[model samples]
Target: MEKQIDNHYRYLQQHFSYLIRQQALLPGEKLPSERDIGERFNLTRMTVRQGLQTLEAEGLIYRQNRRGWFVSPPAVVYNPARRQSFIEYVSSQGFEPSTDLIGVTVNPADARMAELMKVDKGARLLFLQRRRSIDGRPVLIEHIYINTALLPGIEKEDMSQSLTHLLRNKYGQAYHSMNLIFKSTALLEDAARELGAAAGLPGLHIERTNYDAAGRVLELDYEYWRHDAVTIQIDVNDA
Candidate 1:
């Protein structure tokens, strides 16, 4: 009985794998309903679901609420050392990119924030939250803290667009240096919620601190990315 059940799921997995490899099920195309697949395969619904879950773990498919599974699209490449903005890189890769400002607020820096920004406690900072998408699929959530003292009246400016552009054109400030840290972990509750993913899903966490020519911290950014949505590539040159 155990061997038979194992073969049952493997049979469905192999069938879908063949279809995907042949391009019969194109990327981003929805799969058939679970009931339909079960009926076609002469398997129980649980067995069909188990097979689909296996493919999802292999990065061959993904599920959306209400909507069924879809063939996974090609992962976007992100190079940490690259100076391109999110829109620039995504567009260069032939993907449509967009940003939605979740919210913005001015708040006093707490102890940890003060330490990170090298500012005194209670220093005013701008908190900005944004959700970024590629090809209409929400993939990243960014929480940014800006040192308001560095750019006077910055809070009055539009916050939805690229900060790099705003700094260069408006404040005459550009990125001088940055420190970045990347971690692979489960997505947190708030970030997962914003990305339309279930809590505790595998994710990529990126923490970046931006500095100006004078070595003052300009912004501290926390980015949560869907695990399957991005592929990070970096080129190192020997000194």
Candidate 2:
């Protein structure tokens, strides 16, 4: 009986990890109760709990007192020198990447937006907003301000797909983005709803200014990421 219990716990842990990696268990989503897991697996509640505890120790999941276990959001690390697309960075972590377009339109530049993108006041600009997911879990929300002077036909673009790919292939543009700043913030009501996160919870806020080959400010973007679901990796060489 003891051996059987140990095996059951191990099996449960393995299966749970698989679900997490496959994104079947989404970030911020509560895991079924131990009793529920046991009922499904035909195991004892203790056995199910052992599996969940292992995941918690690994920082892949968390238990909030009586709130139950949930997938942990990613951690964010700021590296000033790295240049990579958000998709590329996320994919390298062995997760499926997807984006949900929230809003996309061309509009007159506002005072602040104009200053950020270095476009003129009332200049036509493109606004793109999206919610990004990994393994079917919402983790980040991004808003992009693009100067229409550089890319005139943005309204006709199908940005429900990859914006980076579009810029690279269609415009023959190679963009290198620099991180202007990053800070931690609490989720607003709108952001909380989109991410299924609790309102006022901590999130990672990133502000970036992207440049073109001629050092022109191509776009300015803001990204809000789930604090526990992502991490930045960087290696430093002697300078």
Candidate 3:
């Protein structure tokens, strides 16, 4: 009986996978409800859900809260060596990009933050949180700690726009070097809640430290991304 059920679900999975690959179901297209799918396939709702879950795990589909499943868009390609801003890269890929400033404040640096920023403990740092969306879907949340001493009066600028642009245009500071680390992990409770994903869902975590021309730390950034939303690529060339 279990084997039969597994084959049944596999049939449904293959059916949908075909449609998606054929472009019969375009990206961001919604899938029918479990009841409808079950009725059409003569399978139980549980079986239908199992098929959909498989596709979701494979990054072919995703779910919105109470909105059912959707065919996922192509993953955004991120080349860390390129110095393009988020807006630039996202637009180059033919997707609309936007950012929402969730909060901004100046806070005294704690021990860990101070060490990361290479600043003394208790030094004031500008903290910013933002939600970044692509094609109208929220996919990444960013938390940034700015070294205020380097960019004095930065807090007075608009935080909703790209900080990279602000740094270049306003302060004449372009990114000189960066250290980055990426990890595959489960989303934390608060980050999941903000991204409308269930707590403990698979996610991608990125830690980045930006440096200035003088080799001083400019910012420390932590980013939480939906596992399906991005594909990281790096190019290697022999010097």
lDDT of each: 0.90, 0.77, 0.93
TM-score top scorer: 3
Error of 2 at 184 (Å): 1.3
Question: What are the runs in model 1 whose C-alpha is more than 4 Å off?
Answer: 1-3
lDDT of each residue in 94-123, candidate 3, tens digit only? 999999999999999999889989999999
Q: Which 10 residues in a row give candidate 2 its minimum summed lDDT?
A: 75-84
Worst 10 residues of 1 by lDDT: 56-65
Index of the highest-lDDT prediction: 3
TM-score of 2: 0.70
Better of 2 and 3 by lDDT: 3
Clashes of each: 0, 7, 0
**Which TM-score value belongs to model 1?**
0.92
Model 2, 1-239: lDDT tens digits are 88988888888888888888899988778989888999999988777877887776555776655678887766434354656566776677567788999998889998987888777889888888999988777888888888878876767888777777788888887786464677888767787678776566677788888898777788888888766766655687899
Query: What does each candidate score in C-alpha RMSD?
Result: 1.8, 8.1, 1.5
